[model samples]
Target: MVRKLLFVATLSVASGFKVDQAPVKTALLQLRGGADATQIAKYVAYSTSAFMFIPAGRDVFSPGAEIMPDDDKLLGKMFTDKSKEGYMFMWNQWGVNWIMLSIMKILAVSSGSADFLKLGFATDVVTFAMMFKGWIPEFKPFVVMFGLELLALGKLAFA
Candidate 1:
């Protein structure tokens, strides 16, 4: 998984970046690890260490939620939950991850890059397939945000 993601990361960079990779990687590494994108890309590509794995329980954020002050803040409150998947799921939806994902898809590309993008698109599909399993709240906003962003990138790659 890590190797595949590393390949994808290399390919994404090879593709092209309207914005660059160095600054982005620098910022994200500061937020998480130096290779946070590699981590996310690895997780998205394959299930790694079982104990280290984080189950992305579906519906942690469902539709039609009211805008009231959520007392529990339980929708995506994995940080304080002390549960198995809470923190993993929450961390996946953070700003740094979002930025990294955006950077991955926005890199330079050529005809030779088609296969890598296809692989990336497939990986994303598998990741989304895990959503809404009813095991955790469906982090709706993040679900839509991350989902649409990747979908859009996949579309760009195919186009």
Candidate 2:
């Protein structure tokens, strides 16, 4: 039975129905040894900043206050005012986020490490919290993005 199972496993891997773990483990070991910690730090910073910028842009442009339920309270008005920032602020935030994401991608490619992938997972978690905090039901795009990010994180974390 053991021999039969081994043969099946080998055949499955050879046919690409199963991933061969040896090469992946070897690559991960090499990456752990060779990857620069500073580069990984930079990648994480950029990635996290990029993730934050999306909601920041939305806050400045669309301003969730528009869809917020009507309230005569001063606190509600204050929150609304804070959400509606100037156009320049929103544009600059978006531009900076894009630049950071670009830098992070470059660093990730150069480092050839899985650390960046982990950082991406962290970014998604943080961004998801930010989205949930904002409580904006109108932004369906954010929901879709969160779902996709979670899927990617699961794949990277598990595989």
Per-residue lDDT of 70-131 in model 2, one digit per residue for the tens? 32332243344444556456445555675565455445434645687566566667767877
Worst 10 residues of 2 by lDDT: 66-75
Segments in model 1 whose C-alpha atoms lie over 4 Å from true places: 1-76, 81-98, 108-112, 134-138
All candidates' TM-scores? 0.34, 0.40
lDDT of 1 by residue, 36-151 (tens): 54345434332221111222212133212333334146444434554556555554555344344434444422222566656556655665666555334445544554465455
- Candidate 2's displacement at residue 73, Å, is 21
Candidate whose lDDT is highest: 2
What overall lDDT goes with each candidate model? 0.46, 0.54
Number of clashing pairs per prediction, in order:
15, 0
